[model samples]
Target: MYQPDVFAFPEEGQSGPSLLPPPGVLSLWRVDVARHCGQAARVAPGILDAGELDRAAHLVVDADRECYVASHVALRILLGARLGVAPGAVPLTREPCPSCGGPHGRPATGGGVHFSLSHTRGVALLAFADVPVGVDVELLPKTGVVSEIAGQLHPAESRELAELPEELRPAAFGRVWTRKEAYLKGEGIGLADGLAAEHVGTGPRPGPGPAGWTITDVRVPTGYAAAVAVRAAGQPAARDGDRRR
Candidate 1:
């Protein structure tokens, strides 16, 4: 099994949490956006940058806006604490798309810290590393969506899911989805690049990622699945003994 260093943020009125994962180490954090919704209403006014605030404003759904603001604010707070900069002043930008040259790809920064964020329902996940990192979290599939999209996965993954007991396929599909998305996100390309091209296995352990990239499953709350990917020279060893609280 893969284990990542996880962190819990301090209460809203308290000082921001400080996280400093060692170089080459990937740190993953899971935030319950619903728990921080109230704090977002208060802290977002000052903590979020103009761009983030504007984006939050454009979200029509109240929960969506709250999740967006809370996640972005949490990200800024973590990044700012790590870089010793004001959260509101953290310089954030998105790399141009490799296919169309549009500024809509992976979020990036110049401080030598790479990160990726993803959220589904009320939960959000963030990942940080010295090298490119990508993270994805998904709620358990409750409908036919998994089966509908199974064909989009790698051929082997498709077959794996096809053979699983009907009751177990959703979790298996979620695992495969998060693993594939994590790898693609780490590559600086999102789902726009397509999912069928890469084949992360459907088993509990992640399959090989593209060259120079390592993918690992992240333990998350029940009813959800998450994974993280990092660019590395070689595969990362399972942290069975290094699991941290």
Candidate 2:
């Protein structure tokens, strides 16, 4: 049972909190987009890079754009503080595609830290670790849709969902979905690898992750589900003295 250092956004009009997770300690930060909506325009311009700003501008829906800007700004602020660089100046790169070698997979930084971001509805989640890491958060689907998409999960997960009482199935299915996604993203591959190919079963706790990876369920606000995955055992954990606010 890995416990992540969790941070929440401060009250309105206050500067965002600084974060410096202990080395080897995975940090999970959650932001409520609605709480930051009023300050998005003022804060986002200062934190987001040019590419991120441009991308946010092209989002057709107002809520989607707000979430995009809030999530990216939070990522930049947190990572920048840790890296000792200005938020907008933090360099973010993508890993080459495993199949085609195209530069369009997981987002990365040159400083050796790994991170992943996920957002839905009005909430965003960011995770940071010393080793490669992926985090995913999803808004629980409606009960009717649970059965509709059950087949997309691994056989074991699907069977488990079938056995669950109807009211409990959506949340159970969400756990499986997020666990699978976090593992895939940590591997630098998105759903392109196929969710059905892996067998992370449905339960309050995560089942075995892909070999060499560790998966853990994340505590999230009601109506949302989240998870994080990191390389099981590899490089030494980052040292506490290495981080600066």
- Top-lDDT candidate index: 2
lDDT of 2 at 185: 85
TM-scores for all candidates: the values are 0.87, 0.87
lDDT of 2: 0.78
Clash list (residue pairs), candidate 1: none
Query: Model 2, residue 102: what's the lDDT?
Result: 90
At residue 120, give the lDDT of candidate 2. 87
After superposition, candidate 2 runs with Cα above 4 Å error: 1-19, 235-245
Residue by residue across 1-245, what tens digits does model 2's lDDT show?
Answer: 34444444434322445647588888888877888765765777667778888999999998899899878877877787677777777899988765457998789986667899998878888998888888999999888898899988777788999999899998998899999898878877687656777777788888775667788988788898889988765733222232111
Each candidate structure's count of clashing pairs: 0, 1
